[model samples]
Target: MHSILESVKESPGFTTGLRLSDDDLVLVKNAISEHLANHLARIEPDKVPLLQTTALDMYHTIAGQLPHDKLLTRQSRILAQTAVDAIRTTSLFRQLESQLGAFEISDEENVGRESISIRLVRPGFDTDVGSLHADDWFWKLYDFPVPTGKRRVKIWIAICCEQGKSGLILCPNSHKRDWDYSVIERAGMSKPLLSPDENPDKQIFQSKPGDAVVFNYDLLHGGMVTRGERTRVSMEFTMLIPEDVYQH
Candidate 1:
């Protein structure tokens, strides 16, 4: 895999960064565990410890770890915010700040931040999770206009995911084209934007705790069903170029 800087410079849509330090992972994992524990205080107790282990178990434990359980309600929101806060303090983010101009963490006011979402993909269980897609498609569905001048980026962190199995896949250099504009209504709503027969510039790689991938908001990407017993748990938030930074 190319260094994060090289990948971004080559395509700017997808780049995986250096491994997140043990300290960084600890801060994020603990925060998520505490918040989820608070939310689960009344529903389930045994599953609280599972949150620290892997995302698949956390979702399954809370939802009963059943094939039928698909509800990821309030706890998903908590995970998203907890992730956003933790990622903001990372050295990767610090590097992004210098490259993309100063950024504000996702908040209610920032249209970009509102798109933040938590993702948990489990093997043999597919229901409410995401499919092949880009963030801007849904943003436009809600009538949010894509930024015209300043660049916008998405920050993704894998809390309990690894290489292979059910990890995210991306169609590289897919963001720079105009074809999606006309077909987004039909194609952008689902996962795997292209068929295996289509021969796209597909890319997949391994990731570990604290690993992050920052890409253009317009890139075509989504998770795959894991092949292993472990589940893929991750969170992503949006970053917008600061107006002042562009002004200078």
Candidate 2:
């Protein structure tokens, strides 16, 4: 059998038992739901009672505000704290250094970024999906320097995802090699364009509420939109480790 840590070192990424409790789940769901409804009440007052975001209304104008939403940023901090607490259940965060002393997880984003975000994926083929990409590619695009002695990794926890239905799509083992990309400048911002030949050997990792999916910063990943009805919600955060962990 392949070991978990070894799997992370050798492949695209792996899942862990770390999870949020039932109470935490309720807290996140309610808080975000109310927030989204309130966000719409400002412009579309009649739709407030629609219980949107949970069952998304494609016409809801809130999608334009996702990138800079302050409430989402604050919530990211709160969720990051939850992940740190959940680490007590597994040695993955603290004792992980035993396997690769070059890496470490700070309790907060003291050095890099919160990089924490909440996402809702509505089901159906008509739903818009994110382009194929990797987190670090954007980091480089923005010229954000990874702090010395720290390398980045991503943490994604399923807040309300349906099993085998909706969650993440990762390109297994794609992290080890550089994926060819071009920069497309728009609105004074540069975005990474995945080259045509560098397509992902996509792997759908369906996760449940509270399940944590830690993946490499270079991993080619994206969301899996479902034809089902339920909307998928998930939390994402980032942490760093010693820079040379992967070097010989």
Candidate 3:
């Protein structure tokens, strides 16, 4: 059977309006719901504080890896290589790489290899805000050179509780330029750009469970605060391909 990613590549706007089929969406939602329930059930109320503290530390570390100030916690891997492996084998992710013509690498050790970082964000553990700046740690850590003619792509998977909370908003086509490191460094210098009116091409992805949104790395994008009672959970990662990869 054809994979979802393969199917998406055959259609238009695969990068923009990519969504899961009804059956697939239901499967994703159930998986996410079960995962959360299991984790929550296993945690003791007394240990919750410790878990929150550890999660915060992990969030800061991951955020530092990006060129932004803050990113919503979504999921994590025991090792970086594990995350890389999942991205490589996942049909949805492969389609993304193919659509963007991203660089292919054998493993995480490969300099040009694409990678995905997993994080988990839970309610009460961290506050949800409409906007947050991304850090430039990935460029420095991964040795991804500055953006010239082309840029990398970042995909965020809304794994659980996708009721519009924690959705992303982006300035359309901004990835065609250089990375905006200054925006992250000066995160609170001025009010962070939150709403979509700031740019007409701005697109907000209010994904359903299991839905994923991919955007150019250089694109100006940030997280949206959740107002509902349920926690907003998702996984985010970036795809780094050489400039020549996308040249048609």
Candidate 4:
């Protein structure tokens, strides 16, 4: 087996053994739950707990009704701060930086915060999650500028998921190659989704709330834990690892 850093350097990315503390996990859960509740047009006092119990249903009930971009929330939501703090210390990141020296993290909004977003995937609903594509495509879609001279590693947390059932589905090794694209229907509209030139194998990595996955930004990844009985909620962020090899 490859070491964590070695795996990240050589493959699609590492899928296991990275995590946050139990107490910190709770902080993350509560923070996102509150954020979801506040985004509702009008707070439904009774159904709010569904944010934790069945977020897919909550999205179907509330966020699902809003513009898709509204659902793709920014990290500025106040309650999200508590959640962000806890995620920053996920074991994999600490270890990565320890060996390579510290690097700046960016939310692309905050000067030094990781860019973060929470995702909800409803079972059997293809529109709830996005089509498979590399993260950098979004930068081009929105004309967002990526910082220069930094290597980006994407981080995904299974905030609410079932082990061996629901998690991340990836196109292995796509990060090292360029893939073609075509328009496809997603979220009720035509979107340019990545379609590999050749049929690719799908690799689904199973994970639970405590676990996290880190991968190359160019890797094709999407869809969610869609095999489970309930909705799956997950968080993703990017760490801007410094490329300066000679000095920290």
Candidate 5:
């Protein structure tokens, strides 16, 4: 793992990333596409009218009806959960531990402590082009504090992205600094938001299908518009270890 991290560190972007093989990528993509299709199919015809609505409104409405504990019923949700679990227990995660330094998963019993969360982000159906504001606040509320020596990383997998579709864009290494929550609050007010250049040090990542990108939590990031004819689909998850490391 250290070798992988070292290799990635040698790059200017400070990101060591890889795409899933063609076969695996295809399988994952098919699974997600079918899952989403089924979820939409489950909606009553009368409700289909509502799905035409913007992403933010649709997400809020679906979120209200689908509790966090109940997200597993959807195929996309199940896949996302499985991916997170795999990373948590695999040698891949252990390699990350050595490269990033000691880390621990959040204690399940602790309230208000930063912990892992998985979310399914499907553009177009539940949101429109300008709905990026919602994610700005979402990341702010979930950020957990870490000691000076360690990094807080958030990982995302692009399970399904049609050719030329919009994927996620992230500023790499931006997590090395403290997050500026005031920017998020101000953006929520319909005020002018900072440009991506405001954080030039950040690297923007656009993934192919089945590609995974991991970055520091404090790193400024957001969804990008899908340029292709197809809708953009992806999953995001966060990981953090306690300062003591053994607490988990």
Candidate 6:
């Protein structure tokens, strides 16, 4: 058996773990649900009784917000703080934090729940499924410089992902080699097209609440549309070992 980080290092750049207990997951999930419910109720107090669908509808309401909205940004920060507290209670997270030194959570654009990436994947809807792509590739394309001795990783926690729901797909061992993404077709900064020959082994993880998938941000990865009738929900956040950590 390999350690989680080792497995991720050897593979397409990701690993999933049920680090949080059932109770822990419930606490976090309830926090999110309550937060959304409160927001909805505050907005329309008279309609609070009518809005019974808290999970999918509440998620969509938050996800549909403009990223720059103060409410959205503040809620994202609150949710991130909630996630950090939940993850810290896990032994696995402590182990990684010890070994990795310190990780700074990213609060920048498209990095939080407000970006609609923390979505309710609906079946047969291209609206929900993100195209196959590497996030860091787009960052690089925009001239984001990643210095030596500093690395960033993204962790996505499943709040309610189930089997056959069309979860995340990643190309195995693709991160081991730095592909010439410039050679791939691209219309803009969003999705990068992969050549047929450039394809690698594809992998997907069936996740449940409290399960988390950690991956290199540079890895080829994206979500698939939900195939099951039940909606899938998840939240994502990134952590980077800042350059100062290497100086010590």
Highest TM-score against the true fold, candidate = 4
Tens-digit lDDT track for model 3 on 1-248?
12323222232212555555555544444344333333433543343333343323133333333322222222222124434554455556546555654454322334344444334444433444434333233455445465455434456776555465556665555544444232232333333332334443556676766678755444566666544445555656545555554433
lDDT of 4 by residue, 1-248 (tens): 23544556667555456776677667677777766766643444454455446454245445454543553444333235555666556565576566556765556555354556777776676656776888877665656566788877677888777776667887777777777887666546546677656566678777777688777777788776476666677777777766663123
Candidate 5 overall lDDT versus native:
0.46
> Candidate 1, residues 13-88: lDDT per residue as tens digits?
6787645677877776666656556555445656555544545434554454422222345224434454566656
Q: Judged by lDDT against the true structure, how good is candidate 2?
A: 0.61
Q: Judged by lDDT relative to the true structure, which candidate is superior, 1 or 3?
A: 1
Ordered list by TM-score, greatest first? 4, 1, 6, 2, 3, 5
Highest lDDT scorer: 4
Give candidate 6's whole-model lDDT.
Answer: 0.59
Error of 5 at 118 (Å): 7.5
For model 3, the run of ten residues with the poorest summed lDDT: 69-78
Question: Taking the tens digit of each residue's C-alpha lDDT, what string does model 6 give over 1-248?
Answer: 23545655565567766356777667666666655445555565554444345455234443434221332332433454454565556654665677566566654464443222255565555656666677776655556555455666777777676664667787776777766444344323244555555666776777766677778776777787776655576667666666554232
Model 4's C-alpha root-mean-square deviation from the true structure amounts to 4.4
Clashes of each: 8, 3, 19, 2, 8, 1
lDDT of 5 by residue, 110-199 (tens): 433433333444445333323222232443444524445443445666655654456666555544444433343432332223454354
Error of 1 at 49 (Å): 7.2
Residue 59, candidate 3: alpha-carbon lDDT = 34
lDDT of each: 0.58, 0.61, 0.45, 0.64, 0.46, 0.59
Task: Evaluate model 1: give its TM-score.
Answer: 0.71
Ten residues in sequence with the least summed lDDT for candidate 2: 68-77
